[model samples]
Target: MNTSAPDEGRIDTEVRGHLLLITINRPAKRNGFTPAMYRQLAAAYTRLDDEPALRVGVLMAAGDHFTAGLDLPTFAPLMQRGEQAAPAGGVEPTEPGMAGYRRRQKPVVVAVKGITYTLGIELMLAADVVVAADNCRFSQLEVKRGIMATGGATLRMAERAGAGNALLHLLTGDEFGAAEALRLNFVQKVVPPAQVEQETLQIAEQIAQQAPLAVVATRLNVLKAIEHGPLAAMEEFEATQQRLSRSEDAAEGVRSFVERRPAKFTGR
Candidate 1:
């Protein structure tokens, strides 16, 4: 595990086999994010995307709670100035409107517990998969703060769940529990607080075990379908398959199938 740029709050990154475990560390403040922390996290995301050895990312937090949301005292002025500054040469992990970098091609799984408010929920909503602890208390309370969810929540939440379901929470700024999160299709799994991280890690490991090219291609296709039309995404399937079929990993997949054994993919 490498702790990068320790400041008021920091983002800790660990490379576990092919999985990049990103932890938000600041238990005293319930892991709230400062501007420096956001830059650190963006750097970590950039690291994950640039490293060929890393295939998947698991985002979690240290301590009893996931996050209480942003440190308004630090971020409010920036918001007022209409300036969202990213790292000097790093990707923006949270929202595209916040930075100049492109979205990550790789997949990310998020694990949350206790208080997950405002931007915390937005972050989870932006991720590909979510594992929430039964003790989780989620709220998209930006409206209550005299602001709106500028993150992906406004765009993604309605698409994932129904608009009414998303609006119920987004509009009223009401708190919801894990059960409601599951019902709203906001979380993939709800486990005991003790098991949230382990469960999420297991899921990320499963993704990492697959052929790296195929995994990224699959995620990209899904995202393309969401951003563009399904027909547009489907139009690229033939080209994608033609490319993947020519890779060495594809040959290994055939051999492993013929041998009736688990494939040991080198991400070729």
Candidate 2:
């Protein structure tokens, strides 16, 4: 069950039932991600496509903070790594494995605690749902540190938190409290620090109990709807509806609905 990444022991991946629990293990560094950790995460996620048993996933960290953003030694190498990539259209991919990459299929959940910084919040944006502790602090201070917050938040955060809020946070690089994060809808919910992990897993278990294919399909369609216009989304949704209707799960769902019973789906 322990599929912890071998790179720096920064990531601990374990499958409990249908849920994959991913814990950032570098508590000493406040869970700051090194290059090895990032690559390991990407590598682990890549296997999800082939692993049919993984129905849900959660990302959390040991100790207080979820992450203090990228490690200095690790981040310095990102530039070097980015520079090494063959230039495509005179631009390198912003984040490793991001350009032309499909955001993951299964729902990805996160539990953010204290002192989330800069790219720390960006990782939450990548997740489908985020649960935060009441005292969690968030910021995009890369701009204040003489760098832009180009970790995809400059473009995506606006859609989630509105243009004004995005500008205020990213442009100013100011710290925001968890209460403000909840108000802006950055996090799905905020619980006491001690309850973050429990609450996140409670939600994760609910997610894992559902029909896997339906969850994945809904996640994919919903993200597309957010990125594309409603018309384009409608087209994709129609296509998806047609495909899913023929699945055995669709039939089981209808039968269960008519029978007033819970449906047991095989993820077909």
Candidate 3:
């Protein structure tokens, strides 16, 4: 197992087998993200994508709350200057226009509890799956802060939760409970507060156990359809199939099925 800390320990990362466990550690502030913390968060996600051994990532917070969103005061200067910054070796935290801004090939499972606001919601939208605590409260309250959400919320929220639901919350900046989140399709599962992390890790572990290359390809195809329309995605189907068919793991998968045994994929 390997561990890494970034931005004065604001972000903590631990590797368990093929899963990268990332936790937001500053519960004292309700896990509120300072500009530095945002950079660290971006860096952690980047590490998850860059490391070949890491097949899945679990994002959770150490405290009751996932995050209180951006620390307005700490970020005020950057906001005023209209400057965007991401950590070294990291994708842009808010703006999706940056060259490095792209979704990860591997899956990410998020466990959210307590207050999840603004960027927190965007983070969940970015994740492949979300497990929210029953007590969780969420909002996209950037309009209340006299600013708009810079994260992908504007683009992805409506895609996940429908335009009407996304607009209702984004326009009103009202708080919504976990049940409403699930109803809106914002979260995949809602469990007891204490079970959030366990449930999220369980999902991550399942994804990690899959053939890594095939897993990535599956996610990529879905994203392609979302980003470039189904026709464009279909255009690449044969290419993807041919590529995966050539992988040794694919052959092992077939053999294992024929032998009535569990497949042991090397991610080759």
**Highest-scoring model, lDDT:** 1
Q: CA shift at 60, candidate 3, in angstroms? A: 0.4
lDDT of 3: 0.84
Model 1 over residues 1-268: C-alpha lDDT tens digits? 5433344788888888998899999888888899888888888888988999998989999888999999889999999998774664566776544445667878899999999998798888878899999999999989888988887788878988878888888899999999999998889999999899999999999998889999999998998898898998999999999999999999999999999998888878
Better of 1 and 2 by TM-score: 1
Candidate 3: tens digits of C-alpha lDDT, residues 1-268: 2233343338778899999898887777778788777777788788888889999989888767998888788889998997765754465544355564655667889999999998888888888899999999999999998999878888887887789988999999999999999998889999999899999999998888889999999898898898889998899899989999999999999999999998998899
Report clash pairs, candidate 1.
none
The candidates, ranked best first by TM-score, are 1, 3, 2
Q: What ranges in model 2 sit over 4 Å off?
A: 1-9, 80-97
RMSD of each: 1.9, 3.8, 2.5
Overall lDDT per candidate, in order of appearance = 0.87, 0.77, 0.84
- Estimated TM-score per prediction? 0.95, 0.89, 0.93
Ranking by lDDT: 1, 3, 2
TM-score of decoy 3: 0.93
Tens-place lDDT digits, model 2, residues 23-142? 787777777877777666665565554489888778888778888887766577667565322223221212323454545677778999998997678878777789999999898888
